[model samples]
Target: MAGNSDPLTPRAKLAVTAGKAVAAASRAAGRGSGSVIGGRVALKLDPDLLARLAQNLDVVLVSATNGKTTTTRLIAEALRAAGPVVSNALGANMPAGITSALAGSSEARYGVIEVDEKYLAGVARDTDPKCIALLNLSRDQLDRAAETRMLAENWREGLAGSKAVIVANADDPLVVWAASSSPNVIWVAAGQMWKDDAWSCPSCGGVMQRPGDDWFCGECGFRRPTPSWALSGDHVLDPHGSAWPIHLQLPGRANKANAASSAAVAAVFGVPPQVALERMYQVQAVAGRYDVVQFEGRDLRLLLAKNPAGWLETFSLIDPPPTPVILSVNARGADGTDTSWLWDVDYTRLTGHPICVIGDRKLDLAVRLEVANQQFQVCENLDQAVQLCPPGRIEVIANYTAFQDLRRRVGN
Candidate 1:
């Protein structure tokens, strides 16, 4: 599965050529943010470039409120066994990122892309992907994404006649609801830890009964779907109930679910589950996340906490007492204008841990921590905050822009 290095159609080639020039200019002007502007220019030149590039190619699209970046990375890494793959390695999930990734690797036969949740339907329809991994969707970037129910409904409609085989998360009621309409689906019980978003049945608005790991609507018969692939203890059970040992270098239980979701797709592509997990085990970071690097005088490990659901998982992964952590936040456009989601997280989890708040929303976070009875220090600069931490590997957890800012400071 080597890349298709051969030139494309005349129009597409010309568009790419123009795009490369724009990208070069952007870089020279120090405004180039990865392949963003370049891709945008190419797309502007040839509006059909994405769809055209996707033609006659094996493409897999992964979308979710959180974990899409890591999950896409896992899928792409696993597909390496199948040979050449081009992907959004920078964790850019928008159309520009996808366009840039595809335009550059014209020779690639397989494309593994992480799509923004809001752009799923359009991208999926245009790309005509072979497999669509529908991970759990929660309330993320509400200022930009609005209601989760609306997104789910839109996705259901978008995938109504999709020819792609949907790799679905049966454990997530929202994911199940959105993907159930798809004709061809492979269900995976990847385990949903964040139940706040799917507490009620999306169908009848009835309270979902969660007596155990299983969830069902009392009014309507909607319930967790029977999965062909499920996470049972340390093993992932195949449809035949054969247990496949699951292990990942990626931290948090959420990552385990991410790996399971990816394995389900790899199976559809004929890549064995073991082979997928083996390759995924080598991925320590996606973009700048889960990376350990020296900053200032202390070592810092990065974690991107985008929403309440994501923060819950990250909170659990933090080191206990005596360990210091730097929590950075920003209310930038990319991070969503509303920072209210911070109150939804159980910040009490850091009861005894020392805290250092940094970023644009440092004061807001400081207030949140104080109300939670957690003591903290406010240091907006990452370098100054790093100097304040005790002699140990510090956990630097931040929201979108803050994380990117910290990543740049770490020279990552």
Candidate 2:
């Protein structure tokens, strides 16, 4: 008997098969493989399998160093406000994870995905998104990303010759430069007082200045058209939290940026500003990013700090005369085996002291803290650290793996 062989159908079958195989492989790696694939049998499908599942679904691919998840979710919600939408909301940003998401959806008019920077180009090539939202580029995951410039170049190559409308953050110098070469790009400028990192020519190494939230190359005079949609104001009255009101469900400057990016993406999809505001107010923080929890009669804040950029943003948001904190770091291969990026973080900002250092890499954290003149108690075990630390308004910083372990330990 001959094996099943129909070109299009077989391709579709292969996609399904590969997807299931990926999930199984992830489980075998000791990761929570089910969160995204969720009880789906192994099929080992390929990208073509998605074609069999649906047709004419608009794809929105969102990529950035930070804010991808929130922006993707907000955009998905805004699209959902218009009609039914499907997304991989489980922080699965790679090609396989995206395939799994498409496989699981029943009916979807639009598909919004948060893509990893390294995978963005390939995903874009394969998925052919209708719109690609490129948020600000920042230094993140040095071990993986290597450099922001390289990632930007990869994005440029990935997007070349594609008909996808480019929605970009104009204030980011790298994004501005990348979009300058592309026609049909819609720029979105950050609001007032938004301090962007890419303020100069990425190629010429000249200072790039923002004159009125619109970026222009000071030296080369390379400039892109200002954003069609811009988010500006003192306060947006986010019910989740307010800077002026001085209360936030998620505490940090980064959160504000995340919210702003979300709003911008929502606006691009024709969501009414008023409706966007209302929906944003109802927005809740995700599990690992500045999620406040009440555990054991104590208030605990879980802030995900995966890389140096994240660390800087987290540190900037924290108010200090020395708040008690639990800092966790891990150097496992799966959790970013390289820890050299620690040097890029300005640990001095966390001046006063940490209450405890938890995780397998406690000594490394302790040494870094002590070197920065910040006192800390080291605990090799996460459970021990949690038990020993007193409750009440505690801040916990954890890397990807450590964050997951801590969440499980705290039952969050």
Candidate 3:
């Protein structure tokens, strides 16, 4: 019920007020961040609260199997060059959490939401966003979420006839298939790290032909689209053939690809590429991923990788051998209850590094490492893991719940 030109209905106003109170209480009680719980309460009272709060706002929905949180943060930072922006920057990418984020700031000019792959269609329908940035699609939480092609088909069907501009990754064939139905689409050549899930064509179920960086279906002739935005070594080539250098405090090529996509999404709002890149450089971390924190006189750098595709990209972010890597895994609900995805990741990349494993599924990771012929020690907790290493910078890569556990333990 914060004041706006188009005010919320009385019922929606009451719902928002109650939701805000619940969020405040939850935070005060040290129970949780309260976004999800508060949003659930609000929706139970007024089911249309999300739509009502999103009215008159330029919303951007970001979805992907990986990098969506960071990309959403980057996009939100760039959009701030225009006006006030509201975002679930803490990685709450669900309907309830998104609703709580929007309801909290009723007068914001924009809403940038990170949405789960399974929930994008519903959120898009409610928010009626101005832009939808489809980052990439791969096997993620498969025990809960559907297959990659099925998710892509849902996106294609859900977004059809919608007026939102689709900013999609040209390098990811699944993303291309998902965004193909949209009339207004801007394809950016954001590099894809894992191509295992996209081997077969979604259209004709034929083998996809990849010649260097290009991909085409052998049966139906569905081909990779020419991207308007392309990323070179350290620069992004805009549609006008202008090269803009992407210098970010965030490390890795994945971040550069994310920045390239963010610039393209911001362009739809009239924000220049250089300006967006400048703003994006200020973001040091997103929702504790890649956050460097001090714990027990040691610098612990936290990295979150939930799936095989994400783990492949995260492996590059780790420090070189002898730096000592701590790998943690969990099979909690947030993380799919199947640790079998661990076998898909090539843990042999950590060879020569002093590796330690810790989590609910630490034994599974230990077995995977053993199969890779990599030496590792299983530790009960982060404290024990850190004790094995000397007092210096240590890399801690963990799955979803394990990452959250470390964040709490390290006081991040």
lDDT of 3 by residue, 102-173 (tens): 987855898999999889999999998999999999888868988889999999999988899999999998
Q: Which ten residues in a row have the lowest lDDT in candidate 3?
A: 1-10
Rank ordering of all candidates by lDDT, starting from the highest: 3, 1, 2
Per-residue lDDT tens digits of candidate 2, residues 1-412? Answer: 1122332466666656556666777788887755356323322434355434434467788998767876776677667776678888878776656767776665677788888888888777767677888877776655666677777777777787778778787667777666555566766654322244565577677877766646667787777565555544434332223322212255555555555555555655666545655565545676456677777676788888777767777776664745677889988765667676676677777767456888878777777777777767888776566677665677888888888888887777
lDDT of 3 at 57: 89
Order of candidate numbers by TM-score, starting with the best: 3, 1, 2
Winner on TM-score (2 vs 3): 3
Best lDDT goes to which candidate? 3
* Residue 7 shift from truth in candidate 2, angstroms: 14
- The candidate with the higher lDDT, 1 or 3, is 3
The superposed Cα distance between candidate 2 and the true structure at residue 346, in angstroms, equals: 1.7
CA lDDT of each prediction against the hidden true structure? 0.86, 0.67, 0.92
Best by TM-score: 3
Enumerate residue pairs that collide in model 1: 3-107, 3-108, 4-107, 4-108, 5-107
Q: Encode model 1's per-residue lDDT on 1-412: one tens digit a residue.
A: 2244553678889888888788888878877355888888889989888887787579999998888999999999899888789998887678977888888776567899999988999999888899999988888886888688888998899998789999999988998999988899999998887888888889889999998889999999999988999887667777777787777877888888888888889988889988888888889888889888977667789999999989999988877887889999999999998888888888899888888899998888888888899988998598778788877789989999989888777889
* Stretches of candidate 1 exceeding 4 Å from the true structure: 1-7
lDDT of 1: 0.86
